[model samples]
Target: MSEQPKTSAAPARLPGGNRRPAGGPPWANAGMPAEKSMTFWPSARRLIHRLRPYRMALLSVVALGVASVGLSVYVPKILGQATDIIFSGVIGRRLPTGSTQEQAVDGLRAAGNDNLADMLARMDVTPGAGVDFTALSTILAWAVVLFVLSSVLMWAQGWILAGVVQRSMYELRAEVEAKLHRLPLPYFDNQPRGELLSRVTNDIDNVAQTLQQTLSQLLTSLLTVIGVIVMMFWISPLLALIALIAVPLSMIVTQQIAKRSQKQFIAQWTHTGTLNAHIEEAFTGHELVKVFGRQKEVEATFAARNAALYDASFGAQFVSGIIMPSMFFIGNLSYVAVAVVGGLRITSGAMSLGDVQAFIQYSRQFTQPLTQVASMANLLQSGVASAERVFELLDAAEQSPEPAAREAAPTRGRVAFEGVDFRYQADTPLIEDLSLVAEPGQTVAIVGPTGAGKTTLVNLIMRFYELDGGRITLDGVDVTELRRDELRSKIGMVLQDAWLFGGTIRENIRYGRPDATEEEIRAAATATYVDRFVHSLPDGYDTVIDSEGGNVSAGEKQLITIARAFLADPALLILDEATSSVDTRTEVLVQQAMAALRTGRTSFVIAHRLSTIRDADLILVMEDGRIVEQGSHSQLLAAGGAYRRLYDAQFTSAAVDLDESGAAAVMAR
Candidate 1:
């Protein structure tokens, strides 16, 4: 029977629909609230908790940020004071020559500074000077020093925060990796590899970038806003009230735009994953596409996905782009309003010119934080969206729980399936009330037509899929009672699609038994006839293979995987169409190697070729998930049942092909 791919659970959606929405960009759904409202605080709380290990470093960043903003806010006030001193010197010029000196001396004497008063009495004074240039220079020098100090603090904070962000991301990546291992195989089977890749790579990177680039600024901007607000009130409460009006207007605009843009960003990443999936699928099946003449269709599909991605990306970015410009407009309006009001108060003699100037600076600073907050709104939303995607993967259903203790001893390969009932979906039953057994040191060959549940039997034995009802036992112990690791370690599998990583041939062979010695590795290779080709390569056993095993032929790659299983020396072996891809000569050699490997071990062989399993201790024929026949090859052939029909069909087809070829040759002659 042809093997059917196992059905798995419904795939998880990553925020948006699997593809772009049918209408247009996400904003096309504007005026309607999102299906699920996303607020920043929840994601923020989770992120903070994830970074709790680095809280001390975060606190240091906050402290440095406060110090930096404090210096910045104070500098403007100091500059305003210096301006007032200069203005006073320029405007009040009458008593500067001699009378001013007498007044200064009298004031010093009254304040009990007799020594300073005596010194002032002796120095000659100029009649009139515009300003005290020395004092102004000192104040400017102090301002420059504060600016440098603030800059240094800002740099230090960023340097430390980088470490914090990197370490947090490292932990997050590790957690995702661990989660992948624990997740049930169905999770992988159902989900697209490209989507999963995006979550692990793109989504995590988004979070990292946001934390690194925006985190420090977010803290500093907030402190600047608060400090500036207090300073504005100190300068003039009436003007401070006027500047405060811009805050709500900026927030309202930011919220309305953000609501729409957040949906677009989610759509953007979703389509990005879809686009990636298409690219991956096309490349993986490029040969098939060429043979089937589907290149044009593939290109058209890719163009459609690409266009969807561009639309979503453009919508998100364009909407977010408006925020900064809108903020600037509002900020300018507020700045002008404050300047006009402050100038009026200055002219009325209620506020000094210096005070008016300081208030204007404070007003500018206030608007700056509001603008920054608006800018960060989109970035934070993207980060939070990415975070939610990651967390969803981490929260997927894991594999069945392990037993608290291993109640069964190591398996001796006496496998039994009793009263087995299974199904992929509730309404579709695949295996119904089945039973079977394989004794130790026996080779059981399973043959069936396509969709006959041949591979599903092996899957059940390997515990890849849990049976809905019934128990499978190994060595007279329930397999479920055995620890999963303990159960899997004792069985070795060689699949139809041979996989080799980007490593030396020797390393791939030693994958199962990592500590296998060089001699054993070579022995396994030699036994599997892999060494024949290995010696032809430039580096023999050390020849490096590409990730796709492009450096070796398919037959050679299969031999290497067989060698890997041989090195493992599992107590039970599973070969599902193992020799299906090999040439006739290689198949004979592989059969020889498999015969040796099967000695004294129980094995399950799922194959269509009747010739390969002719010497099996038992042959079982399955159809529609039921065992229709079971016997030795000779006995099954003698019975003239399902096994006989299958054997007859294969050989008959081969004989007809041979006769037709000979007839064609005769006719040509």
Candidate 2:
């Protein structure tokens, strides 16, 4: 197992007063934005660097490609030599013998020179003539040998390339995930989950898809075309000259098509990502759409996104569709030119009939590789676009600078925020001129109406965001000076909405401290009243949970979260609305477990409902990002300040509700 990157904020509040969202997490600052078009503008060397480690495999594939094209040169020669051999024998007035030479030549010589006797004599046993099997046989045997070798090497290349592409994609995604784990809380505040998902899943896939489908093919085609063209010129320079002229003409046409299609493909990919984001957002928030009756609007938005993708895809593919036909026409033109010119030369005795046949074959050969190379160009562009996205993710700024080792651990947990100020953006300060302190082993209960920056204070303690003014210290040391991982290991947290990753109940319970044994897990669970719930289930602690812990109730989720923190046993434990969502009975159970966990540890409890914070060593009442009033519950009530008013409102409402139900009970009696 890998050691997870520690986020700057220790396990503090989960960004909400209660479970899940306080509207959203706290996404205030985002680095580079994804470009609207998938037009990757990075140079070739950087793009191919993704494939760097697999150079040996790529080289092997290239060698095979050259060998495959090398076979092309031999086929024309084989046919040409066979034709030459037959014509030569007919001119010599003899038939070539398969079984030794002299007997057949003698039989041929017994007949007149016009009777094919001299043809046999020339084939073998003649003074200055012999069969020309060497050239024909060499061409045929090499063609077969090259065909088999090319297939084997290409297959091997495919397997090797797949591994390189897949592994790189996996590494890229895993690194991004690790960064997300380390990134500050503010980074997630206002961001959309669907947009992040696009970067990890869709964007990475695009990069890998480009490599797997198009890049290796392009390289292979390029090598093939180069090798075949060289051999074609070598065979007959005059015919090669005619065939080469058609290349530039054909290329000019392809270049125009390629440029247009490249733009189209870039737009198509961007629109595709947009389309995915819209669909993902709408589907994930189906309940919100239904409650708001925004179904029609969402549908309209989806349809428009879908239409844009379709138009872009059609345009790109359609533009590319013209390439093959154009190349085919060009190829045929070269063939016709070769045949007409070579035939006149052969008749004028300046060229052999065999040479004319060979030139025509070579002309077709030249276009086959060139046409494939041109057609693969669009696919090449798509791959480069994907690579750009991958590189962009790899190059994001670090969430926070790594802390140096000279700093010591904050032992006492005596946290103080002195005249502190914080802002996610320059113009908007969330917490302004705030000052507070939690002496070691002290319980600080933070209460507020809403948006009081209650949770923001928790963030400040962990140094998740830098203070704009003043400073916060932990045990006489500036919290920022300590390494983030070592700083967080000392703090434990229990949130209202606990995210249980897919794992067994026992595994979830020990998430905070993975080295915790079964005995420790059971003990922690018992303290949190989680073991009781676990025992009630058939599998007990062995039960598996999904990402949301769907098999368990909301109350059970909170218990498991508490149990997890209990096991970690940190110096500071933050209970950010852990019991805020539970029923009265479950809340009491969770509170008991919290009490056990809080012994010998400093705790920060951010709560609503007001009933639970009465026992806090200090109750800090906050409003509009500042602490308005704070004291013990009785003291605040006696003073009748902000805290007293809030307490009175809850008590009065509870009394009235009891009376209404009490009267109904009396009537039934």
Candidate 3:
């Protein structure tokens, strides 16, 4: 069974005597600020690196893009040739029948129309000939074939790229999951659950979408731009240069707009994570909010976060939205210039009418791709911003590595904390140079006030947190020398909150030991009083527990956890306020079951009720982080120290309550 991460120190008060919430520290709820602009390139580079494994697929996509774009670029030129055929036919038809082209040109020149004469001279036309219907039809059919081929190649490229992106995302998600396990408990303590979840779920999903939508299109657009530029230069260098002018202008516009929008995009996603955190917290504690009549406060907080998200999202989209229109406007300018220049070149006979027509089409192709690329800048920025978040999570500090040579599992549960010094914060000492030894088969009951390091003690025993100094040992073997899994395997823990996953009661009990037989499970249930309550239900042990375990009473949940621990039969057991949730009658039964379970095992019980620990083999009274008194319960009470005060404070109040209730009952009689 996997050991659960321990954040039991959540109940401990900080140095300033302020209580920290179970979820996280206060600063964790504060939204992250917008990232610096410089991170964009680094994050983009890292995202690109994630795709390195798919190089073969990407190369295939590139090849298909090139082939598709080459055909598409050449088709426009072919269509332009068809246009020339129709135009030349119209001019030749207007001339006298059986007249040669030379005669028509000379006639036009003699008529003082040199421009028309020059243009006609450049064309390959027969005098009095009409349109070449058959040739035009053939060129059109070839153009259609090229278009179809180009489309098929583009579709194939998209399919390959989509698969590559999904696979990359799949690997990325797995890495994040592994990273989460490797990260230390303090990392979770300092981070909001919803915020971390957003990076894993929402951000990764957005990255997948961004790559899916943009990768193939970006490749195609870039290839189309290159192909169009080559065709433009071939047809007319002067026109190509004019068209190239718009490239720099588009670049300038895109750069300026992107600079303004990048931070906004980062802010947008950051706020999304923050807002999700708030929503999660609010919903998770919705009962507390209603019971305390704090719904208005929750709503107000949600509205503030929601509004911040809206502002950031609107700013990002509005700024990036300017690129496509600006690109179109610039493209139109280049188009007009190319048109006028191409007309002049045709009139001067420097370029053929067919060539000029092709140049115009090339200009549109070039500008269209540029426009497409510019429009995709928003998605690219947003995706990279999300990538940065995921990378940050992946970069979190992980726990120290386990020793290469591991100690064997401890058979005798002799636990010792030697010269152990620990602090949640570096400067504030909690447990300092504390030494303790629990001999095998001893029930060490620890009694302490709230935030007196009760839960932290058990956590240290489980190796949940590393000590700043000193070592903890089990059966004369250092815990650090043992593999965490091997060490944790011999330990069973039941916390104040009885956690149960969504499953039947039988399955939950079986979770303690997957290999446990049905007889063992039922025996454990019977010992813990779970069998009594479970059998009363229609499904008995088969009754399904919801995610929240709402169907079972709080006391029943605690009993189920006790049964689980009993089934585990670990050599060492830690119960952190395990019986705190049950009522008086059930607590007695649970304590009886615990006594039977603790017979041969070493047990560490953290409790607030002095009555429960009165018969403990050893009772250690802790104040702050030190054990002020240690002895049997009666011995500590006789010493009349901290333990005596604590005992009096509890039993004295109980006696007074009993007397008051008795007098009230007498008056009623």
Candidate 4:
């Protein structure tokens, strides 16, 4: 059956009419609200919860990070020891031969240079010795070993974190996939397809990247900052204090910039979803757009959405980009302060030259991590924004659950709608107190104008939407008591739109019943006349259908669907405008096949063509959700009511066209 017509004031609430409102882009629908301020912590916490299963791997990464950062922090101190050894040897070579180090210290003290004497006492030196290259070489060697070991541990940490992130993302993607299956039909009707696609593809990818890039680096940076601070204070407290002043300033900078950029990141992803929806719609309807001369309008809308996305992306990047430079400025100031203080301490002999040098290195190490942390703020914000979108999808309301104990479906199809009451919207009544029955082996044809709930009737029989009141039964058993899958397995349906997957023709036909033997497949194909055109092709049944099924004509596609339904051997069959796409000659053949298929099964056929249903056991004429007239075709035509008006209208138009053609031909002759 054709789709119900939509009104300009109200959205479509039934199948075929289940689309976002017209006259604007899908994102402009009232259902899709403006982008709100991101709830970063909640979304981030939920994202982190996805890693609960990887606790052991994450702990291993943490242990490696600690060892690596510890070794890295100590290496500079070891090198500082080597520096002291070299300096002490140079001084010792200038002293008198055989003079004790204690005697030199006393001599310096006697000259009233107490600070220099104290510095000399701190160093391990012999007054008469030359440079201690042996000790220096040992310290340098240890430093190299520590550096290499630290690097190995850091690499191992990164490797573990990468695995954990990927595995977590895999679980997340699986959950999203499963969640999509559970969402109700109405949810999809209100949502844009491309928006959902962006959430599944683009948003998940962004979240994965954020975790892969930031998790390891952020962990190591924070650990390095802690280790460096401890080493700095151990070497010289005064210089440590001088270096610590930059921490607050860096925090202030990060906090302020992140606040401004967080909203922009949210806007960026929201616009991305909207733009994706627009592109998907435009491409899917490209032929229609071109036929209507709306190519320029489509292009204009695309440009506007693209520009919005660009502006949002630019604003987010620009605001977050300020962080690194500001951090560098703060770090440089700390480095200078530490350097000047260390030099003065050395001149006063309050600190050893080696200790001062190690403290200076620690100061740089401290500031570098702070800078890195600041730089990563943008990635964290963007990722959290995307995570929030994914979370929303995962949290959408699901369809009603199945019963724990399911009733067995009936073997024979005897369907009845007893005092059924339903409506797409609470206020808009479509079907009220509707009652009907189709006995076993009977053919029931439903005829209706557009928006007359023809397709909605079949959809209800399939339990696509729940009734507002009353119940439907099959063979005197409530359909709700049976498992949906079990009930649906006994029925076969063919929709108006002939959907085919990208595969060989044989595979598409076998999709209806996977366990059907090859012989049975060919038999069903021949019965539906699909073999007529398929056999003419080079590959015959093996001919491949593209994603869009463009290689096959519409009639061929319809035939394949019919063959699929035929192969099911269903107890109940539903054909919704099944032959509307075929030409007159093909339609006649299809009608014969359908007649054979419906021989002993209860069938419900929804059709607009009145000529197709003249032989049906019963004809139901529906108008505005009510069965205004129903009986055998001859009886209804005899009464000259709704069914007679419809039948007359169709044949009258055909008769006029035929007479006009005849008159024109005679005049030309």
Maximum-lDDT candidate:
3
Off by over 4 Å in 2: 1-44, 86-139, 153-167, 283-298, 406-410, 653-669
- Residue-level lDDT of model 4, residues 306-360, one tens digit each, is 9989999999999999999999999999988988988878767787788888888
lDDT of each: 0.83, 0.71, 0.87, 0.86
Estimate, for each residue in 63-83, the C-alpha lDDT of model 1 and write its tens digit. Answer: 999999999988888898788
* Arranged by TM-score, best first: 3, 4, 1, 2
1 or 2, greater by lDDT: 1
- Which stretches of candidate 1 lie above 4 Å from their native place? 1-4, 11-41, 93-127, 405-410, 654-669
- Per-model TM-score, in order, reads 0.90, 0.82, 0.94, 0.92
**Error at 111, model 4, angstroms:** 6.1
Cα RMSD to native, each candidate? Answer: 6.6, 7.8, 4.1, 4.0
lDDT of 3 by residue, 1-669 (tens): 112343423343442455555534544434463223346788898999999998999999999999999999999899989999999898888889988889989999999999989898989899888999999999999999999999999999988998999999999999999999888777776667888899999999999999999888898899999999899888888899999999889999999999999999988998999898898888988899999999999999899989999999999999999999999999999999999988899999888888988888889899998999999999999999898888888876788897786646448999999999887765567788889999999999998787677778888878778888899999998888887888889999998888999999999999999999999999999999999999888799999998778999999999999999999999999988899888999899889999998888899998888788877888988877888889998799899999999988887978989999999999999
- The collision pairs in model 4 are none
